[model samples]
Target: MTKIIKSGSGKELADARGRLAPFLRDTLVGLNYAYYEPPGAQMLHNNAIFVRSHDYSEALSTEGEQPWKTPRLVSSGGTHLAGSLADLPYALAWVEQDFIVPESVQSLIWEDLVPSLLTGAVLPRWWRVTGNELHAVTLYQRAGEELLTASAKDEKLRQMVIDILSDRMLPQRSGRLEKALRAGRLDQVFPQIMPADTFYLASEFRRRFPNDAEHWGPAGKELDDLCHRFASEVSPERLSQDFGVPHPALAHSYSRELLNVKPFPTFQDYSSRLLAESWDSNNLYWARLTDEMGYPPVMLNRLVPQLTRRMVEKLFATNLDDWPAILRAMQETGEEFRLGKTASLPKSEATPGP
Candidate 1:
């Protein structure tokens, strides 16, 4: 039996305190749960219930900058909070299935479709813009994921999605990997060190030593090709190929198999699955950054714009006579600013708010 749970302004929230009481009472009784509603605005006293939650502390807010942007449930025993947007029903379904929860509930929440409207509350402009390559990489990966999920029906389309996703995702780790390579960690730790400086070092090495190519053979050549391709584009198949593994049949299976958890199954089933999952992961990362790193959203936001401006300024400052070289450097710097580490500015310079 599909249990229909309807939530909205008219049916979910009412002006009469007495009349509004029973619906909450009934919802809790029907689901074997308890309910809570935050205080309404005093001025209009319009009975605008800002938030609602189950007895277990599963919360849903209708107020604040990013109201519906936050989780509906902060799992009591878990570190992660479960949030959903109406735009990404497939993601909600994936979560429900992965968690072994009732898909009915997932459908119900989505049918209510409160999150889509909440975008007005938590606008994209609220996402603080900056030149952080990591953020750019993340955005690219997200956009790629969306593209992939939406293209999943076709094999060629899936491959294309995987290619773009993998490519953008790779450069995100370049700063750290490059640093490690420079520090000679790869030579000491990795079984065989490639002559190249970064993640695709093996490819560079293979390129330089075609005679030794027989040693690595088809597998090595494939890996080298995969890595080189990643420098330009990426996808689940490419990611799997790079890891010398097969792509997973199941969607969103990151743990049981690394290759399986490509976020979107075929790269065409966008239906909100990837976005919801990605947003959950991103929110958790952001939450940790706030809790552990002491970097609040406001502070993080202020830092990015300034850092981007500074990076742009520095590109112009370098005294270079060659016009083409200068232009190339500027373009590279801009790309770096768009997709690199220098996106985060010092905390001291972070603005509080407008």
Candidate 2:
């Protein structure tokens, strides 16, 4: 029987480690682990043992000293573990205990476009994000092809991102919008790409709290409050049915544009076309692409996630650009590491969201 990894199989991880460890040593942990490299190799072996703890809000936790003897152990608290006293930066890996810790770590690693990433692992989001500035003078460019019609972008996949920030629940192209994102002068290089409303809201959010230097408070929390009200007033089905533009705040307005799909699309036809769009833009044309595809918007936003990711990945393959360096601006401390540039993104993993 084939052992599944993402769903978190302790046996499969143990078995793979046993089978692959001899020649590679713990390098097999790279198959399913999160490793970190601090400044000047601050931590031993420069790899972190990331476990999915119930209360690890410190997102980047600093575990002081670890027992290298414990190859893979699950604590009573449910956090998974994988580390070693390899004596060198010989291994940087981790595996899931009860949760898919390795998977999450891998996701972040792949998002960056360093030379070490597998030959094709660097993505447009990593490149375009610099121009768009997803925030912090850095971009998290997770986009599909330029050929991707606006409507072809999958809003369902986009909306799946958790609002960890709590405010501005909508994801914006990181612009040097507010004073806090980076030096105010960065605006000379990165033109503002966030929607005008989004920019205004983000600015308003930052203006309220002068003391929070990073603008980590997420502004006035208008997006959160609006979402809270939306939750109270609207049923999820109605929301998904009515406003399917990926983000909730844009849903109501977005639905209006979809309502006007030229020639009007039947439900099945609309659904099929929606599954094809790979990148999203707030522009009205994207919402109307199904109409252009002969699949008008008479139906609602009924996207299928599994099919969407596959289609988007195909789109991602066609047009790839190399990422630019941003070493001068950001001071990203702790747990910073990159995989081999020739290393490929792990296949067979399901990313339901883009």
Top of the candidates by TM-score? 1
TM-score of 2: 0.18
Question: What number of backbone clashes does candidate 2 have, counting pairs of residues 3 or more apart or in separate chains?
Answer: 25
Listed per model in order, the count of residue pairs whose N, CA or C atoms clash below 3 Å is 22, 25
Give lDDT tens digits, candidate 1, residues 136-209.
22232233223223333444433433343343234434344334434545433222111011123223233444
**Residue ranges of candidate 1 with Cα displaced over 4 Å:** 1-260, 263-270, 278-280, 292-354
48-88: candidate 2 lDDT, tens digit per residue: 43322212222224465444532443454444344443311
TM-score for each of the candidates: 0.20, 0.18
lDDT of 2: 0.24
lDDT, residue 48, candidate 1? 29
